[model samples]
Target: MNIEIIEIPKIEDYRGNIAVIENDVVPFEIKRVYYLFDVPSNAKRGGHAHKELFQLLLPLSGSFDVVLHDGENQQKITLNKPDKGLLIKPKTWRELDNFSSGAVCLVISSDVFKEEDYIRDFNEFLEYIR
Candidate 1:
C-alpha cells in the first residue's frame, strides 16, 4: 500500500488564496468530482475502496484521519490543510475517521460511479489488490 500527499500550490491575492486543479496535474484522468462536508460527530464514513478508480482527497475546511490497510500493512494519515491532499491509489482499502468539527473532505476520482469498480470488503480488497 502506497500513500502520497500532494501539495497544491496556493496563490495569495488581496482577498484570499486560490488553488487550482488542472487536468493531469496528478495521476490518472479525473472523471468525477465530489465533496464530503457537514459531517456530524459520533459517526464514521468511507469504509470501502475502489477496485479501479483512484482518488485525490483534500481536507478543505478542518482536519480528519484516514486509516488505510492492505491486509498485512496498515497506516494512518492526518489531513488538515487545504493546500495538501492525499492520493489514494486503486486497490487499497480505506476508512475515514476522527473528523474534526466541521471538517470537509473533497475527492477527485479517476472514474464515474460503477458498482463493479468498488471493492467494499476489506478482505476482498486485500486479495484483489494482490
Candidate 2:
C-alpha cells in the first residue's frame, strides 16, 4: 500500500495550461513511456504486477479507474485529472478498467519491456510478495 498520487507541476497562462514532468518529479529514473488510448468502454487493461518496475499512470484525457493490491490490502482510485498521476511500486498487483470515451492513459516506467518481470497471475503475485 505504498502507492502514491503525484501532482504534476502546471504552468498556467491566459491561453492554456501546461503540465510538466521532470526527472526530479518522479522517484525513479524513467526508462520507458507508453500510453493506452481508444480503449473500448467495456474493455479493460493491466491485470498484472511487476517484479521490479515502478510505474506512474497519468490520465491525459477522459477518465479511468485503477485497482491496486499489495497481497494483503486493496485500493481503488479514479484518474480524471491530467495533472495528477498514480505511482505504483514494485511487487504490487494492478488492474485497470472503467474507461471513459477517448480516455488516454500515460504510463511512465522505470525500465524497458521485459516479459520475465511481469507477474500476470494474482496468486503468483501474492506468493512472490510474501
Candidate 3:
C-alpha cells in the first residue's frame, strides 16, 4: 500500500487546539466530512476503499490502527497523535482497528456520499485498482 503520512498543523489557543483541512491542503478538494467516536470495544470499521475520492484520517481523541492493504502488500499505521493525519489516495483498501475507548476518528473525504463509488470487496478492489 502506498500510504502517505500527512502532518497537520495544530492551532492551539487558550480554549483548545484546532486543525483545519481545506481544499488546498491535499491533492483533492474536500466535499464530505465524518467522524467516528464512541466506538465499542473490539469493534472494527472501514473495510472499504474509494474508487476516486481521497481520504484524510485523523485521530482527534485517543489512538487507533489503520491497516492498509494493496493486493500483494499490507501496512499497519498506529495513529495516536492529534497533530498528524494520514492521507490515503484512491484505490487503496483500508481497515480501522485497535480503537481506544472513546476515541474519535475524523475523516475528510474528497467527494460527497456515493454508494457506488466504494469498492467493498477486497478482491474486487484489488482487481479494480489494477
Candidate 4:
C-alpha cells in the first residue's frame, strides 16, 4: 500500500487562500465528487474497500484520520490541512475516524457510485485482496 499526500496549488492574498485542483493532479481521472460535513465527534465513516475505485480525500475544514489496510499492511494518516490531499488506491480497505467538530471532508473519486464495486465486510475485503 503506497499512499501519497499531495500539496495542492494554493494562491494566497489579503483576503484568503484558494486551492486549485485540475484533472492531472491525480493519477486517475475524477468522475465523482462528494463531501462529508456536520459530523459528530464520535461518529465515523468509510469502512470499506473498492474493487476498482480510487479516491482523493481533502480536509476542507477541521481534521480527521484515515486508516488504510491492504490485507498485509496498514497505515494511519491524518488530514488537517486544506492544502493537502490524500490519494487512496484501489483494493485498499479504509476507515475514517476521529473527526473533529465542524470537520468537512471532500472526496474526489475515479468512478461513480456502484454498489457492486464496494466490499463492505472486512473479512471479505481481506479475502478479495488475497
Candidate 5:
C-alpha cells in the first residue's frame, strides 16, 4: 500500500485560515464526504479495506493516527494538521486509532457508499490481495 501525504493550499488572514480542495488536487475525484468528531480517547474506527474506493483523510480539528496494512507491509501515520491530508488507495487495510480530545477527522472518498465494496474481514482482505 502506498500512502501519500498531500499539502493542501491554504490562505491565511487576520481572522482565520482556509484550505481549498478541488478535484485536480487528488488522484481521484471526490464522490463522498464525511467527518468523525467527539470520539472517545480509547475508541477506534475504520477496520476495513476497500476493493475500489479511494480516500483522503484530513485532521480538521485535533489529531489521530492511521494504521495501514497491505497484507505484506504495515505503516502508521499521525495526522494533526488541517493543511495536510493522507491519500489512501484501494486494497489497503486501514485502522484509525489514538484519537485526541476534540479531534475531527474529515474524510473524502472516491465513490459513493456501497456495502459490497468493503472488505471488512482481515482474513478476507488477505485472500483478496493474493
Candidate 6:
C-alpha cells in the first residue's frame, strides 16, 4: 500500500532518450546502487522486507512482476518501462518474479546492505508490522 510509482525525468531526442535520477527525484540520498539481471524466467528474486531501508526498482530492460505486501494489503506491479520506477518503503514485503528475457532491474537504495535489516520470513514481517 505504501508502494509508489515514480516518473523519472526524460530528455527526448532524435537519436535517443535519456532518463536521469537527481537527488531531488528519488526522495532520499542514495547510499548504494545495484541491479538484477540475467535472471531465469522460472526463478524469482527479493523475498524479504527491510526494517528501515527504502528502495526504488526500475526495469532497465525487458519486464518483470513485483509482488508487494504491507501486512494487510497486497499488490502486484509490472515493471516494463525504463523511465518508470517502483518505490519500496520500509515494513513492506516484496517478491520479484515473471521476468521476461533480458530483464534488468535497477535498484537504488537509501542504506547500505545489512543482513540484520532484512526480514526474510513473511510471518516475521507481519508480526513486526503489527
Instruction: Kindly indicate the candidate among 1 and 2 with the higher lDDT.
Output: 2
lDDT of each: 0.86, 0.95, 0.86, 0.92, 0.94, 0.97
Residue-level lDDT of model 4, residues 58-89, one tens digit each, is 99999999999999999999999999999988
Query: Least accurate stretch of 10 residues (summed lDDT) in model 4?
Result: 21-30
Q: Per-residue lDDT of 1-130 in model 1, one digit per residue for the tens?
A: 7678888878989999998877746688888999998787557889998777789999999998999986678999999989898999877788998888989999999888899988887778877877
> Could you tell me which residue pairs clash in candidate 1?
none
Best by lDDT: 6
Clashes of each: 0, 0, 0, 0, 0, 0
The TM-score of predicted model 6 comes to 0.99
Weakest 10 consecutive residues, lDDT, candidate 2? 121-130
Runs of candidate 4 with Cα error greater than 4 angstroms are none
Task: Give the C-alpha lDDT of model 4.
Answer: 0.92
Query: Per-residue lDDT of 1-130 in model 3, one digit per residue for the tens?
Result: 6678887766889998887666566667778889999887599899998888889899999999999987778999999988789998878899998999889999988889999999998889878877
What's the C-alpha lDDT at position 63 in model 1?
Answer: 93
Look at candidate 1 and tell me the lDDT of residue 54. Answer: 88
Candidate 5 lDDT by residue in tens digits, 1-130: 6689999999999899989998778778778999999999899999999999999999999999999999999999999999999999899999999999999999999999999999999999999999
Off by over 4 Å in 2: none
- Which residue ranges in model 6 land beyond 4 Å of their true spot? none
Q: For candidate 2, write residues 77-105 as lDDT tens digits.
A: 99999999999999989999999999999
| Candidate with the greatest TM-score versus the true structure | 6
The per-prediction CA RMSD against the true structure, in angstroms, equals 1.4, 0.7, 1.7, 0.9, 0.9, 0.5
Supply candidate 3's per-residue lDDT for 70: 77
Tens digits of per-residue lDDT, candidate 6, 1-130, equal 9889999999999999999999999988899999999999999999999999999999999999999999999899999999999999999999999999999999999999999999999999999999
Cα lDDT for residue 123, candidate 3:
82
